[model samples]
Target: MSRTPYTSATSQSAKMRKDESFLGRLGGTLGRKKKSKEVSELHEEGKKAINAPMLPPGTDIHPEDTLLEENAERIMLDPTSRENPKFKDMLKVLIDWINSELEEDRIIVKDLEEDCYDGQVLQKLFEKLSGRKLNVAEVTQSEIGQKQKLQTVLEAVNELLRPHGWSIEWSVDSIHSKNLVAIVYLLVALAMHFQAPTRLPEHVSVQVVLVKKREGILQTALVTKELTSTTEMMMGRLERDAFDTLLDHAPDKLNVVKTSLITFVNKHLNKLNLEVTELESQFADGVYLILLMGLLEDYFVPLYSFFLTPESFEQKVHNVAFAFELMQDAGLKKPKARPEGSL
Candidate 1:
């Protein structure tokens, strides 16, 4: 019968606090789980988008063709690719080659995209390359006339190059639209097919933005892509030829050149408490090479410009490419070695 008087208000207040604490903990756990799941899903989506085949649906392509098509699309879409130093170099070389070849006709190409969009330059270049004049018009000021001429030139060029296993990556519409990527591809292919004396840059890679529509929503992804195999094959041939000549004519000079280069690199890198014993292997990852260039040129390379700790092959290549860009900016000639070659 001795039940102490209970304070009803205090009991209710305590109970409410307990319930609130439990609900808070439960909410936090649920929130964390949901966040984790969302992160995992985003990561997977990114991987899929990056690795997804860029070909059209229902299209079956050979393994070799897949790379070519993907590279072509990436270049076509990448807005920054035109500013790439390698692309600029290739464009200049192609223009010079075209001018030299068409000098007899007094045709000089100042701008590849602008001058060629009218189809006049392309027609003359095609005739010069193929050694046969096309039946297309000589001059056209109208849009329809330009497109018509472009179609004729592209068709004939494709017919002539396709049989030799050269696939044209450009179209009449793309060319008439003055698509720089397509124009560069077309010019590079013609240069290779005709055995022009121009030396194109090799292993050129570009960052591309790909846009896709999913569930009526548009999403974009950025990826890096190497251009077609045509340029790579051409550069490979040149490298092999140069290497053979060095081996045959200056076998002893190879060691001398290596020693000199190593000395130079070490002299510059010594300031950073680094020494390069093997240039080939040490510079393969591009870390030391970037540092060496920065040191030798007396310029500070912003840490943000390159990966300080590159964990992937692609990152290493990116570092080397950045170094090459730095060289170009410094008014130095870029070495013949491809960015991937450093690896």
Candidate 2:
């Protein structure tokens, strides 16, 4: 084949085209880099907008949902098994955080369905607010993230323990978690206290009540001692009124609840004349303590039948009659048959 004469101009034009192609590739790469940088800047601006001044704490957070709403939603959205290692690790860390802060030992997320558990948003917010890609290690143990969580937990725990003269010293590694066995042990501890002897005070003016807080958190208070639950429970107007009446009666030493409690006992026991009015008339606290102690035996015997047997109301009262010393059952008094209800 006869070849056409190749010109220097053609050679130069081809070379120029090759150079242009190289320059075009370089410009494309630069354009992509510029786009990525712009995206990052916009993301930062979005974060700043989100972090703008907001409602104060205890401000009614969005229609009463958990703090962990998004994390859980993400998990549910992820199509990963609950047993997935990454998901489990997430859960494990979260559970540790929650059980530690709440002072409970529930091992699974299902257990928290009843309470305020909104960690997902808070967690994702951390990544967004930080503008950092968090790896598993960072997500679980990032000092900044954990510190934020710790501050929140400290505030809640301090709030929980304030009335009880208890406080949690905040730290990354806190002792809020209880091994499953330890949880069982606490119940045993409570049992031991009941079975153990008591240095029954001459009288006691203590009370405990279960209550639900404004944030759907449940707690208990010393009802007779503090009457703090009216606000803490965030009770409705009428409920507060009723609580006011109930609380009003308790601290005034005219405990109608216990008075009616005595009447209920007398009716059931078929014992002669177990009078509550007599106890109320004198406003005797020591006798009231003994009476309530008697009532506890009836209340508890259903569960602790092995230790406390069902007995007549009179008999129950007699059971708690003697002083129980920690070292030994001291001053064991005989059951006195009261023709009249002195206590």
Candidate 3:
């Protein structure tokens, strides 16, 4: 049998084919790399075009006048202002005051923006404070209806404030649009004007962002301003009558206050598998108070020192007095509250 002999011609042809295949693959890889680089460059160029300055060169931009335009929208409170401790405290006080005033009507205001945008709460608050109800709807579900109600309510509120020589700081459109700064301003003004028996924080300030359109271009400015200074001054001008306690002037407020205290107490007590419902009756026994003190002060109260289940008024009073004494021993200022008062 004759076998095919390996030849130089055939070997040379195979080597050439291999070299051509490698060259084709290498060329394809380089082409792909070049195409990727071009795409990346185009992407960078597009980003640069988007981020470029809007105004043409040599077009003068007056910072103050642009921000002060009548059509300018105060967009939002600055993050620094919204997160400020004083601002949070002021918002709490304002919300508590509103809840205290409207508690009897079963109107609970949890958020100033979400709740007041519909104008129902504001109208009720106005009627409750001014003792004059406007001819607005009690509740409106539609945007148009809410706007109409807001217009009527704000107009009446402005009228009420005008007689006191104070101009309206918020507009109907602002409130209906849920502008928090505008809502806060309106609520603060109402709180001060009505002298809602709650004490408002003085000299609170916040930073706001104002946005305006000039020549079809949007411009923004950061403005820092006092929210409560004017209200504080107005409050100061009023007569210095002795402020009535919440229990005396507004008994409904006492219930709301009691509920809040109970919630706070329960939050701490829940760790010990305890809950508080009625503060007056529950704390009257002084058992919860003693436990609360021990938990808060991080000290173990001797079991023998106080009654766990006080069956009589005298025993309850003893437990409360012992708790107060423990507080005093811990260098805590003795509360002006009396132990017998709880009993």
Candidate 4:
């Protein structure tokens, strides 16, 4: 057979192309694997971090606390605004107070029996939220009188919060993850609610929820705090409480909401000259909730921030949407809208 003679330049070019194709495919596979590994590593890190021992409530561990403030400062420092200095000063004081109080919590629970204070469920939840697991044995009930201890700690917490225009409330559940979860929710809630109103600038309302899961679980604590403009707080409370009360008493709050919806529809009914379709009626109350939520965040919060500085409006709005989406995504069922004219 005649040897296929290729020009030297042509042969080299073909070889180079083959090598390049092989390397490219290999690099592509490697790149994909690297990305997959990175994602897996992040998931693992998140799980580990959530399970990490909770730093004492008032204080933080490592450089995280300082870093948070430093980052906050950088983001918030506006030379033209007088409120920036005030906000930074407030943040420093608040962080210090939290650290001190958390230290005290550790001391109070130090002598309690580990078994009695064992709150695995509460611990898990706390770990998820704060990236720290509290030492329940170090903060158990037998070590301190329940009511008195709670009162004292709450007083200190209130003191820490008062200057910042925040408030704390405590509740106990005898059944589930008792005090452990309650405290966790309280801290989380407080952090969320601690802010100046954007819309109702003069008024600031911070509300935190403290739940111990089911009733009678004294060993577990759960707390949740949400901060909003006073106007939003009032409106939210009116909205939330209506639902809560309705749930507490069967078929009651629904009547009220129905009445409200009907009244609303009646006023607009003739104007729109529209009959309520089944689909329209089903979404009526939900649409109202969406509107109310939007109004509270917009007209109320922005006005509140007008007095303090408009820094928190974007964050607060983003947080509300995030919270709503989170609940929705987590399988929390949305309330069904009652048919219009049902009232």
Candidate 5:
């Protein structure tokens, strides 16, 4: 009877190791899944808090008009400098004014509709830059003229940027998820342009396409105020016209931005390799836009604090802004909020 004593150190050890590995992997997978689910749940909560466009059948015309100024306060309280020195400060001012008064955008959404406005602007600017004729929607002010679209879907994009205002939107499509996807398409095109500058290179240029963008002050403040349209005021012309009128007389808060922008640009031009003569509007659109994008970046913090909004939109805005900011000749992150005592 040959009975060999079983070795506890060999087979048993291997089985124990296998179980550990499997459990470890299982824990890791479960951990990642939980994090992702938590993030998604938080995102949906934020959207539910402040999310929109044309009135849907179940649309709440007046679903809690109370928006917190916490976002503004947070930025204002922080004396520390962001990317640009005045970035956070200016954002505080813009958010402050937007909440304090509500003339054009009575129903101010804390979400990221400003991206739609920017997309429209970018579409027009690209056409001009590419030496193509401005599209009908880009050139015409009259909504009636805009009625005739670009013939076919293949002819041009026919996007319905809802949560869009009745106002003639001329903003940077910096942050909204819908606009972020749109901006990604635009960035691919922009990258193509930059990789070649004038034309695509025959060989690899080794250009880096950085996904993260550095945001400034104004882009954060570029909130969309979808004017509640009624049967009596359904005319697009009238709606846009009213918006234009609102712009004619700048609120004291916005006026400060114009002044500050000039001073900031004038001082920073030499560093930018742009001479005083080259600082005019037409030539300096690149610089101005980069700076404006920064403003929005700055404004985003305060804006997010208001609704517990997700940082995804702000990150995308920063990504695109960084892309634009780097384009003078040629020349852009967020944290989640937790309770005071939370670990």
Candidate 6:
């Protein structure tokens, strides 16, 4: 101020720096005090919130265990409120639903052994030893051939059906969905013939039948009947011996029937390669027709019966009682041999 030699811009900068440092130090001290007070207040609020329930005027629930108790209760009560059905019955329904929706899927299994099903070795024996190749295709084409194939599949199916005192037969209506309808029909028939528990829902029925038939084209139909009703209260599970016996007695009729059909078709086609005949293609068509028929008999129709009414499920307990009076019938006959023993 007293003629200070007129300070340059650099000197002014240095003075300003010293003043700014002093102000910064003072501001820092005040800021720290304010932050400490704010932190203590927040800590007090948190402690109050946590202990509020235990305090003079807080919620009744204890703060310490609230979260843990809530999680445990949720875990315990959740499943009971949902899906109330017997495990077996639920599984059956699910399987039936899947089978119904997936009706269009055609299942085919192959085997080369002649005796794999229905004494196929014997069939081959007849072919090889008969001098003339057995014209399976020709035999399968005509109405007679179709019937014969049906009979063959039936025989294989009976290998399973008979031991449990179950029987299988074609429906009179010639329905559609050979696989689906047939299974339903089989179930119905078993229910009708046996004294077993109503394994199938009372309103449930399966119908697999022929909707239409053309030489090379066949239309099939499959349907399941279901109704809601009070489930019949039953006792303990059937004896393990009885259940196992049923399964063991008739293990793989469906598998046998399916394999037989494939072999029959393959054999016929192979025969066609060796020699030409007017009826070769026609026979091939017949084989195909029979294949479908066998499928209906084996997989489509019989499955319903096995699931709906089987010996181990106590479906055939009385054999002459409950089912007969309450159900519509289908398969009822036993295997019969012709008087002359014609093959």
Q: Tell me the TM-score of each prediction against the true structure.
A: 0.45, 0.25, 0.51, 0.20, 0.19, 0.20
- Give the lowest summed-lDDT range of ten residues in model 4: 70-79
Name the candidate, 3 or 6, with the larger lDDT value: 3
What C-alpha root-mean-square deviation, in Å, does candidate 1 show against the real structure?
Answer: 22.5
Tell me the lDDT of candidate 2: 0.35
lDDT of each: 0.73, 0.35, 0.75, 0.37, 0.33, 0.35
Residue-wise C-alpha lDDT for candidate 4, range 246-287, written one tens digit per residue: 777877567667677666654444343543334333332333
Ranking by TM-score: 3, 1, 2, 4, 6, 5
Which is superior by lDDT, 1 or 2? 1
Rank order by lDDT, top first?
3, 1, 4, 6, 2, 5
Q: Is candidate 1 or candidate 6 better by lDDT?
A: 1
Q: What ranges in model 2 sit over 4 Å off?
A: 1-16, 25-29, 32-343
Global Cα RMSD, each model: 22.5, 19.8, 18.1, 25.8, 27.3, 26.7
RMSD of 4: 25.8
Clashes of 6: 20
lDDT score of model 5?
Answer: 0.33
lDDT of 5 at 123: 45
Question: What would the per-residue lDDT of candidate 3 be over residues 50-160, giving only the tens digit for each residue?
Answer: 434543333343444345444555455666677889889888878887897799999888888899998999999999888896998777889999999999999888887
**Candidate closer to the true structure by TM-score (higher is better), 2 or 6:** 2
Better of 3 and 4 by lDDT: 3
The C-alpha stretches of model 3 lying farther than 4 A from their native spots are 1-71, 230-232, 237-343
For model 4 the local lDDT of residue 302 reads 34
